[model samples]
Target: MKVCLVGSSGGHLTHLYMLKPFWQDKDRFWVTFDKEDARSILKNEDVYNCYFPTNRNIKNLIKNTALAFKVLKHEKPDVIISSGAAVAVPFFYIGKIFGAKTIYIEVFDRIDKPTLTGKLVYPITDKFIVQWEEMKKVYPKAINLGSIF
Candidate 1:
């Protein structure tokens, strides 16, 4: 299956990377920030850099939404996954329109509350995964997969 892995550069990227066992054999590409860590981690993989400082940043959000439309149309992945900061919002929303399955893994750090990106994408996600059981309370339909760390 073709997979589109999307996230921010640092911890979000790392969280997605930890699922290498699941994605390693699949036809996959990444959508992330064009930062040192992202470059280093995904050097051998296909990478698309999206606009950043996305938290509460309207400009980057618009830019990324456009980028998402372009990439999702081109890739036409079977699935889109992310442990996000903000960039995942556009991809997940647009990917749905492309008929791609969407998975959102809530970051491991936030046990008591949902991240902004998580909240935004929750309604549309095909599978909503939570790293902590407590997060299920915050996201009632979320599957508790425990920590990806």
Candidate 2:
């Protein structure tokens, strides 16, 4: 199955990369920011660079949504998975519209507090995974996948 993995550069990307063993067997590509970490880690991977200043950046999110539409249209991934910041919003929405299964992994940092991205994507997500078991209190249906660190 073709998979599209989306995440922000920092810890979000780190956790997603840690799952390389899981996705490597599938046809996969990445959607992330063009940062030093992403540039280095994704050097040999199929990647689509998104705009920076994400999360609360309405302008960039809108831009990234358009980019997401284009990418999902062309890639036609069977599944779209994200360890998010803000870029995941557009991709999740567009991917859903295109009938791609959506999967979301909440970042490792938040145990007590819920991420805005997580709340937004949870309802549409086919699989919602959390690193902390405590997160199940916040996301009752989330799967406890343990730490990716």
Candidate 3:
């Protein structure tokens, strides 16, 4: 199976990395934003960088959309998994439209409060995973997968 492991920089990527073993036997690719930390993590993997806008305002949504299309066209992954802050929105949306199974893994920090991405992607996600069991309170259907790191 072809997989596109997509996420923003920092903790989001770290969480996804913990699930690396699952992709060890599959055809996988990494799609992440360009950040100094992201550069370090992607060093030994097949990776594609996407323009991750610093601003989350409405003005930059169009550019984010374009970047999403670019990555979707090039990768053509059968499944797209993301630990998101902002960039995952476009990736998940475009991946779904392209007939890819979209999986959303909520960030680890959301033990007490619901994150923006979690709320937005939960209902639409083909698979919704949470690191904390308490998250099930916020998203009743979320699967508790424990800590990734």
* lDDT of all predictions: 0.94, 0.93, 0.82
> Model 3 off-target regions past 4 Å?
none
Q: What TM-score would you give candidate 3 relative to the actual structure?
A: 0.90
In candidate 1, which residue ranges exceed 4 Å CA deviation? none
lDDT of 3 by residue, 1-149 (tens): 89988877888888778887898788898877788888897888888776656346565557767877887888789998988877777778888898999889888878967888777777778999888988889888888988877
Compose the digit string of candidate 1's lDDT tens values, residues 19-133.
9999999999999999999999999999999988999999999999999999999999999999997999999999999999999999989988989899999999999999888
User: How would the candidate models be sorted by lDDT, starting from the highest?
Assistant: 1, 2, 3
Which lDDT value does model 3 have at 141?
A: 86
Write down the RMSD of candidate 1 (Cα, Å): 0.6
- Please give, for residues 47-137, the per-residue lDDT of candidate 2 as tens digits: 9999988969999999999999999999999999898989999999999999999999998889977899999999989999998989999
Worst 10 residues of 1 by lDDT: 140-149
Native-vs-model 3 lDDT?
0.82
lDDT of 1 at 125: 97
Q: Which residue pairs in candidate 1 have backbone atoms (N, alpha carbon, C) closer than 3 angstroms, thus clashing?
A: none
Per TM-score, the best of the predicted structures is 1
**Candidate 2 clashing pairs, residues 3+ apart or interchain:** none
Q: Give candidate 1's TM-score.
A: 0.98
